[model samples]
Target: MSDRKPINDAMDHMNGIEGYPTNVDLKSLPKPLRYFGYFFISFFVLFFITFFVLSMIL
Candidate 1:
């Protein structure tokens, strides 16, 4: 007898856990949070670029 059903029907959230947010909605966030996200992403880009440029120069 098959007793197991689908773990998650939609499987949209993380690990198919209900009510677990998988992502941050940038459009829904307030202005400050949106800017912070942009800044956080830019920091990574600049950090890698700086290291690469320095390695090439040295």
Candidate 2:
């Protein structure tokens, strides 16, 4: 289609733009709390997976 050319040209122009920031400020929780959060989520996921598999098997 004739309309495709303008759209393609616009996309090509956007590809050359510099979008990354030179500096960033990062914040995070304490190490112990972060580890606890990770463990909690992992255990929750494993528990549900085990439950579903057992239900299907029985």
1-58: candidate 2 lDDT, tens digit per residue: 1223325866746644633333444336678877888899999999999999999999
Clashes of each: 0, 0
Top-lDDT structure, candidate number: 1
Candidate 1 total steric clashes: 0
lDDT of 2 at 11: 71
Error of 1 at 12 (Å): 13
In TM-score terms, which candidate is top?
1
Q: Which whole-number lDDT from 0 to 100 does residue 28 have in model 1?
A: 91
* Per-residue C-alpha lDDT of model 1 across residues 1-58, encoded as one tens digit per residue: 1233446755544334544444556599899988999999999999999999999999
Could you estimate the TM-score for every candidate? 0.59, 0.53
